[model samples]
Target: MVEALNKFQLIGQEQTRRYWETLIGSGRFGHAHILSGHSGVGKDALAFFIAAALNCKADTKKPCGNCISCRQFLNLENQALQLIFALPRRSANQTDPFTGIKEKEMILINEELAKKAAWPYYHLQIDAANDIRIAGIRKLRKDIYLAIDPGTTRVIIILRAHKMNMEAANALLKILEEPPAGTIFLLTTEYADRLPDTIRSRCALHHVPDLNWKLIREDLLQKKGVDPVQAEICARMSMGDLAAAHGYAEQDNTFWLDRIRATLNTLAKEDFVSVHKQVLLLADKEEQTDDSRQQFLSLLILFFRDVALKVKMGETVLWATQSQQMNKLFPNCDSQGAIKAIERTKNALERKVHLQLALTALFFELRKHLRR
Candidate 1:
């Protein structure tokens, strides 16, 4: 039997891996753990690995990758895995957690989950999902107490746990305080501080630090078959987010940068006609997926950051070619206001606001900020 479990390409965090392996091997790990970290740092991946280890059927070693249980976990077909995350709001009188979810929304959620299962580092997204509602937690409370096989551990993972509203958070707190036997809770969030203090106090916090830039670049080049030049650019632009770096590797960075340049000029000139056209293009389902939309927004933010760098340090990093035009347009760019507006738009998008409306508002906000 293999003594060491396969990491499944879970990249770095040697210390975190060693700690969990030892604890899980000893069969004395805590009932609850919160994997807190910035985006794309493998918090969810680590949590999934730990959950797999806990439920692995190998007698002498945990997560013996060859076992039936491990195979199921890798395929995300493991019966023991329970995933919870933010979802769109249900009807006011709807008590069933999933009954109110529209068919398309459900399909999107499942697709994102499958992607995450295939690549542990992949970030999951559902366009309409915003917050974890109480009904889901209520259902979980019932499900946790159900009977399971002997020696099996039920793993419940709540991704983006900080999105839990007050009602759902309180409901989850009750479960953590007196968790059911043979069950484990793994909560992950980029914004752990946003979680209630009481909930934070109950779980063991494990901070997953950002991945190294060189390591990300290497992974893209070796495993992802990304071009060396593009890989380096994505790695640097990702800001230590490996998942974002992977996504960037697949995207046409130049195209997005060009779009941003054109959009910025329109916003600066207060051209509502062109601004509306840009919004329609951005919101086009035929042209942009939810992931692409998010990528576009991120690129826009980076573009503004480049402007700030150019204004403050006399040099722009990401798109030096565009720096000349941007300088000519806004000699004194108000990057602070522009960034704040982008953030507000990002928040609005997460809340399932209409894409056209959100992008339109963002353009107006940008016009206000960039006019100076």
Candidate 2:
């Protein structure tokens, strides 16, 4: 059974793989397991792999992904595997209200699965009420009580488990307390603290760590077919989050990079013209989305981090292509100041403060750091 974990293909988190393999193999596997970690880490992926391995009929090569059970799980088409995720309840414009809401949710969930099938690093995005409602859980409770095909292990994965509504969480807790034999509950969450203590206590907990930069860099190049330099950049920017690195590679990231470069320059020089230009550009289509804005801010943080590296390790910066700027401003740039600036900007955004004003303040503060 331990050998099975070594055979698993999950990148990074080797410890977690071994632990689960041992638990399942020893017949000590808990009915519920909680995979807790940062968003975009491989928590969901690891959970799915464990579920697949448990359900597969392979004798030694547990998830010999070639088997029917393994293949179905890989495709997320396994009848025994149930995937649950948050979907907004209903839209204001939903006409039928009852059927329309359920139909819409199903459509969105199918779309999410399609994305996952095509891109292994996809994160489900539900536009409406992003919480698992009691209705879904009640149905699950009923379904789990029903019959199971003999050798088929029923594995239910509740993704973004932290988003479960209170009622849903309570309902799930009851099931966890007395889970049926051959049924497994795998819950993945970025915020395990939000789960009730009773729910957390019922499940075996696995902490998923971020993949290291080297692994991410190699994965991006080998698995994702990204070019060397761009792959390195994406991996560095992603900071061990493969999902984000893949997204950075898939999109024409230059759109954001160019703006980010411009903004960085404005911050360095306290240039009124460039700052004003950025405000208008960012307010428009390209930089408007929260994802875009967060990416932009993350890039800014990385840029300063590179500046710090440039000062500490001459001729070496993460974004080697941006060395000219790093040399120009960050020769004496305070790393603490850069960190402070990043914290301020991140806090402002998290608090839902005015984006433009927050960014304006960030630039002003950054100017002091780079100038100092």
> Which candidate should be chosen as best, given lDDT against the real structure?
1
- Give candidate 2's error at residue 99 in angstroms: 6.1
Compared with the true structure, model 1 gives a TM-score of: 0.68
lDDT of 2 by residue, 1-372 (tens): 444433334677778777777887898777888899876778877877888888888886577777888777777888888888775666433222224467656787688888775554578776765677777787788778777678888999998898898878888888888888889999999899999898999988878987887788788878778666567668767877888888788865555567766776676664687886777676565638767777777777776766666634343334555645666656776756877887777777877887778777777777777767
In model 1, the runs with Cα more than 4 Å from the true position are 1-7, 59-61, 93-95, 254-372
Worst 10 residues of 2 by lDDT: 91-100
TM agreement with the true structure for every prediction = 0.68, 0.78
The whole-model C-alpha lDDT of candidate 1 against the native structure comes to: 0.80
Give the TM-score comparing model 2 with the true structure, all chains together: 0.78
Model 2's number of clashes is 2
**Cα error, candidate 1, residue 92 (Å):** 3.0
